[model samples]
Target chain A: MVHNLWTELYIVLLLLAAVVIISQCYITYLFHKYEQAKIWKVIGILFPLGLNIYIYQIIKLEKRLNNFLQIASMERRDWRTAYLLVLAQYLLLFAVFGLFASP
Target chain B: MSKRSKARIIFFLYILVLLCFDTTYSFMIFNLFLAFAALELSFLLPLFRIRNNKEIVMSMFFVVTFILLSPNAIYVVTDLIHLTFFDFDFMEGLELKEWWNFTILVSGVFLALFYYVLMMDQVRAFLGRSKWMNLILLLMIILSSIGVYIGRFLRFHSIHIFTEPLTVVFQIVHSLDYSSVLFIGWMTILQIIICWLFLDEVGVKNGT
Candidate 1:
């Protein structure tokens, strides 16, 4: 019984995550349309993409071409790039449960 | 001196250590690891990539620990939040853990801007592959993913270490779905060869 409950919870959580991601993307898109908050446009757009890359830890970390991604021009470690991506990941995962718990 | 690489290495070490530590003690270790990850994150602060203000940092720590601890942790955070707000029922259905989670996420947007100050340029040198390194990278990815799956299974089964190794070995062989594994195995081999060619071309372009 407990196992089933936990599995159900896990599945619900994944669905919640999918909704939150899609919702956030929409809100970000709307903001982009409004011509408000220049800073958020870059972040609101790039953050999600950076995030999707980070959580994919199963994909071993080798060097991705920084210039290729347009994240940074140099081949060196893009500290800011890493943070934005990793942070987005954690936040998305964090907000997910709440999305499911509600209604 | 790329601290990023150093930080990555440290994070890798921490994960391995956490896996080896006794499960009961793992929470303490996990909180510590969360702190370490946060600290490593701080090195990026100067670049403004990761905003390091107090509220944001606390929220980050709280959320990281909250996730690391699991559901029962959900209650303790809720109770604490309730005590502080004096609203026993603030944000209905919002457990302390969930609320903390939301706060961290909401705050991240405001914090995203400080990231561009840091200059980056260390990566151009190593795109070419050693056939051996490619093989090792592939092996590590497979092993780590299996480790993750096994870790979850053991937690569910309530089984501890004496049997953990056995499960880990079983997981690697049985891990990926059969058809996908066959496809991925070949794909990975091809990737290594393509990567080698690309890196060689980049080298030639640079040498010009």
Candidate 2:
């Protein structure tokens, strides 16, 4: 199982590398075709920002799916249970704080 | 900017600030968020929609608790980071005066946890794809968290037998390795998930 997972990971990594190489190649081709090295430089500068944007998109999609689930099923109100969940969240914070806090 | 767009911008900027700064300003921003969340929840929850005593109680509880938890979040991270960076052992070796510095050290650590509970939904959104994307993200988070926990455990465990590095990796006996990378990375992603969840929740509650 581990072997297969590693194999998959390797393949995925290779594909990612390939995509980067291919995009760079395409961009270089376009730059030379248009004699616009300046544009290429701009693309290079913008790539990191693009990745951050991509990450932002993924987070948005995940929330949509979760909302779908919650909507379909009512998060039924049990005050006691709700209160407890609230309290549990609090306790988790408190314990974490105490563990690390200066008394 | 629309209210949400403004909030979204603030929220995203706040997250970046948290990751980058890990300071009292970040904590204050986060605490204010808890206050905002409490106010938002009061109006947006179904119980509040119905208008009852229960709603009032829940809102009050939430407001108070939110205030309490926000600081705790700050405390946890500050403490852990301070201790780790400054090399303060939690054991008997420390003088009382040194403890204050330790608080500031580990402050970044709770930021990881904050990402988990507070931001998971938003992260999922940022990383969102099909079910497969989510599954992959979940796995990544789990692995990174285990990785980070292991690192913390091992470094701390040298103080006593309980801190054994083996104990850190002992989860591997059950296929567990507590790692901060997994924890923080997963949490980083999770915060995105949470942002989306809040948006959705508010959207539904407020009507489109």
Q: After superposing the true interface residues, what Cα RMSD does each candidate give?
A: 12.3, 11.0
Per-candidate Cα lDDT values, in order, are 0.37, 0.39
Encode model 1's per-residue lDDT on B8-78: one tens digit a residue: 55455545654774332234333333334433343333233223463365445533432232211111121
lDDT of 2 by residue, B47-154 (tens): 322245655675555543433222222223323443443444558686654554433333334333333333333333433466686665555445434433433343
List residue ranges in candidate 2 displaced over 4 A: A1-16, A22-103, B1-106, B121-171, B174-208
Candidate 1 residue B126 C-alpha distance from true site, Å: 28
Model 2, A1-103: lDDT tens digits are 7686466446545654554444444433433443344644454334431232223223442254332233222332432233334344334343333333311
Candidate No. with top TM-score? 2
Off by over 4 Å in 1: A1-16, A19-88, A95-103, B1-3, B21-24, B46-208
**Candidate 2 — what's its lDDT?**
0.39
DockQ for candidate 1, please give it: 0.05
Candidate 1 residue pairs that clash? A75-B122, A75-B123, A76-B121, A76-B122, A76-B123, B47-B118, B48-B114, B48-B115, B49-B115, B78-B96
